[model samples]
Target chain A: MSLARVHNFAISLDGFGTGFGQSKELHFGHAGDRLHQWMFGTQSWQRTSGSRGVDNVFVRDTDVKIGAEIMGAGKWGHPGWEDDPDWKGAWGPNPPFHTPVFVLTRHQREPIEMEGGTTFHFLDTTPAEALETARKAADGKDVRIGGGATVIRAFLAAGLIDHMHLVVVPILLGRGVRLWGEDIEGIEKDYVIESTPSPSGVTHVTFTRKA
Target chain B: MSLARVHNFAISLDGFGTGFGQSKELHFGHAGDRLHQWMFGTQSWQRTSGSRGVDNVFVRDTDVKIGAEIMGAGKWGHPGWEDDPDWKGAWGPNPPFHTPVFVLTRHQREPIEMEGGTTFHFLDTTPAEALETARKAADGKDVRIGGGATVIRAFLAAGLIDHMHLVVVPILLGRGVRLWGEDIEGIEKDYVIESTPSPSGVTHVTFTRKA
Candidate 1:
């Protein structure tokens, strides 16, 4: 069975996955790259060499086999990429995700295959349906939930997420998209939660589904 | 100069200081002590003997000299506490606070002296003015900001808090009063935020005003 998983997701202290006023130039809006500094500091992101700190431990995903990914329209492009036919994705040719990436959006388009086995497939569907399609595309490996906040909240509220690893950044975004709320109250009952704080001042929290 | 400090405050993963549907019986409402389990497990609250681990390190507050406290009405009594004239406080005879406590409410009742040095003073004033009154009563000692979420946010938004120690529990209350949001956007620029994860899964986050 292919498990639905979310990895290396970062959010603000106030629960904002990204900051307000996002634009083409600002993928995370006012948030800038503040939320992902931990990942960037990791040896994995540094490639040749970097710190092997606790943050690197949670961020390292080279051992896992991810077959496919499901992301939302907000993450696929700038504000209005649908208007331009030439817009492929924010990720240039040879994107990082080398899998069949399912992009959830009302404006469905034909599949566009990028270099490095990454293909963008537009779909207008619910969380459950999207996960099903992504699972099939994932083959026998786990399906990664690539998010920008709204998409992750939807899947979490729907109880479709089997495992989740969220990094809580120290800053307070004040305004932006929230990752959790009253819609998913008591969500803790479904998962065994654990948190590990790194010396880097960020706390990495993981949620594993109950057996 | 006396500092305004917040200590041992517990909030949910989603930033809810307390739960929803609060009543006389449920101060934290749907949260039902879940957000405070970390504190209860500490040696301070446990009284006899408990884990002196990282959680206990943050929960211990006996060393500080607290002259006065300012808390919201919700922390003083239940939802309809105003209707009852005989209602003293939730903390029976000897309240844990051995100092004057200023309760923020519109009722504007007279001061009620309790057993110990604790005395409840009802004030219908702004956060700054209330802090002034509490400051005088504090007699040069630190003024602790006792909260139920709204009170804390008010002080925080007003830029009056000097130091805040918040414990982020692993659970998600889903529905309740939020501690941070758009109202306080960019507030992080004012203070230095640091987080440390405990062995018990709770993350202790502290914010210290810049020098």
Candidate 2:
């Protein structure tokens, strides 16, 4: 439906997606890597990242549905390096998500080349603008909000998202950056719960938006 | 030996500790159940919750560790009831935490007993006051900052914690609640990476208070 759906925006249970005052060294901070356990074992990610394996139906279905992805600059890790053109896409080698990605940033930079069909488009655009661009590029597929928290919250606070898939891994990053801030106010969310447990004990839940 | 340990608090990667509006029904929210996957499989939780004959290390450790606990009125999802002599602890049949818990609420209530050693104490004390009471009641043990977000944040901001174990679940709950607010400023955290994976693919990271 061309709606902006913030799919799989991983944040810390501590209300942070990334730690505060983020630098390149602290992308997602401390135990931030723990959040991606679900993706690593998934066929969608494995195939894209170049691995040969039998696929789990649930993981496969969930992975291929994503069409476009967006993230804030912090999620992207760096924004002021446009002049140097030294920025690299967060994923190394062949990245997952063989789709277009829109990165929200302040400084304008050239598009980043990535493996697979993924391309990192740095946009100084507002949330609405990025959503619109992502929607157009998504080609009827869902627009995934890959985030560092503030970016996703912006879209969510504006009520622009349609669905969210939250995978709750069981690790805690006590401190670093927090994605959710109390400064945000005036919002309501209604979700239908769809939960499934992988053999590894990672619970994958899909929250379809209601109103 | 009291130090402000990083990772003492945990949050759902979706940025909510529970559902909105602080309603009792909203205690865990739709996906809130997934947040406690670690403790659910813990031996301590299993034994206390009456899930015996289940051989699992994670479950056993988490259960016995929280031998006693506490909460605030706001976290209990009920107020005024705390003033009653019959105020009971949350969880039915057997509560989630099998230990004795002292809750810090403005309302004073009699200690309501449960099937297990778990009891609810509604205290009108402040953060320090509650900690003093909790420490004594903890049987010279670790006092868990069983949270409703605000309560945990209060203790954290007050520098009253020793060690924090944070499990970063792998999902983003785009909207609902936040852990820290803009009003919470100038706080610092340091963490060491103690990352291990649970059977459920949930990473268990332990953070000690850095001197």
Candidate 3:
């Protein structure tokens, strides 16, 4: 059985996944890269210069055994991405996700086959429907929930996530898209939560569903 | 010079200091004792039966050299506390705070002297003005900010907090009054933030002002 996993999802001290006023140019808006600065210093991000710490260990797990990816429209491109037919996503030619990536959006578009093995498949579906589509595309492998906050929160609210790895960054982004909503109370009852604070000043929190 | 400090301030993973709809019966509202279950097992709480761990270390620091305290009216009493003129604080006769504790409220009342050196002084003043009264009453000792979120947010917005110790419990109180607000975006630039996660599933976060 394949799992619906979320890895290396960074949030501010205030639980904001992305800052306010996120635009085409500024992906994280006023937050900049502050939420993910800790990962940049890891060996998985540097590839050649960074140190092999707990952060690097978690960063490397981003690509481990994950087949297809499901992300919200905001994460695939900017706000007005649907208007532009030539939107190639935030990642360049060869995206990090080498699997068949499913983009959940209201405005549907044909599958765009990018360089490398990555292909962007647009779908207008609910969290459960999208997961079913992504799971089939995954081909017996796990499906990674590539988030922009809303998508992850939806999946979480629907009780579809099996494993979630959230990194709590030490800074507070006062205004942003918050991950935890009013419907998320008692969500911990379904999962075994564990938190480990690394020396780099970020705490890695994991919620693994009890079988 | 005496500094303004905050200690043993517990918050949920979502940054809620206290849950929504707090009443006289339900002090923390929907959150119940989940936000503070980590402290209940510590030596500082159980007196004779608790363990001496990192939680106890920070818990014991709550009353270290704190001559006076400033807390919000919500922390002192329930929502409609002003109506009851004869109501003492939640913490019986001999309260935990053995100092001049100033309660920030819209309605002013005469000071109530409790047992164990805890005197509740009601004041209707701004964070700066209230701090002035507390500092004078502190008499060369540090003033601790006892909070229920609003008062702490006010002092934080005013840049009057010299030291802040926030404990992030693993639980997520989905709906409640949040500690971080829009005015606190670049507040991290003023202090050195440190995060230490204990085995008891709580992360102790400290913000020390740069000298």
The TM-score leader among the candidates is 3
- In candidate 1, which residue ranges exceed 4 Å CA deviation? none
Candidate 1 global TM-score: 0.96
Candidate 1's error at B147, in angstroms? 0.7
Could you give candidate 2's per-residue lDDT for residues B20-133 as a string of tens digits? 544455565554565666556554555656334322443344444443555656666554453555435456767766666777765666676777566777688778878777
Whichever of 1 and 2 has more lDDT, that candidate is: 1
Query: In candidate 1, what are the lDDT values of residues A1-211, reduced to their tens digit?
Result: 7899999889988888988888889999999999998888888889888889888877776338889999989999978988999998988898989999999999979999999999999999999999999889988999999897899999999999999999988888888888986778788999989888777778888999999
* C-alpha lDDT score of every prediction, in listed order: 0.88, 0.59, 0.90
TM-score of chain A, cand. 2: 0.75
Tens-place lDDT per residue, model 3, A102-197, is 999999998999988999999998999999999999999999999989999999999999999999987878888989988777788899888888
- Evaluated with lDDT, which candidate comes out highest? 3
lDDT-best of 2 and 3: 3
lDDT of 2 by residue, A46-117 (tens): 765632332245445544667888877776654444555666666775667688888888777777768888
Score candidate 1 by DockQ. Answer: 0.79
Better of 1 and 2 by TM-score: 1
**Regions of model 3 farther than 4 Å from truth:** none
Residue-level lDDT of model 3, residues B1-211, one tens digit each, is 8889999889988889999889999998988888888999998899988979899999998888888999998999998988998888999999989899999988899999999899999999899998889989999999999997888988999999999999888787888888888887778889988888788888899999999
Q: By lDDT, highest first, what's the ranking?
A: 3, 1, 2
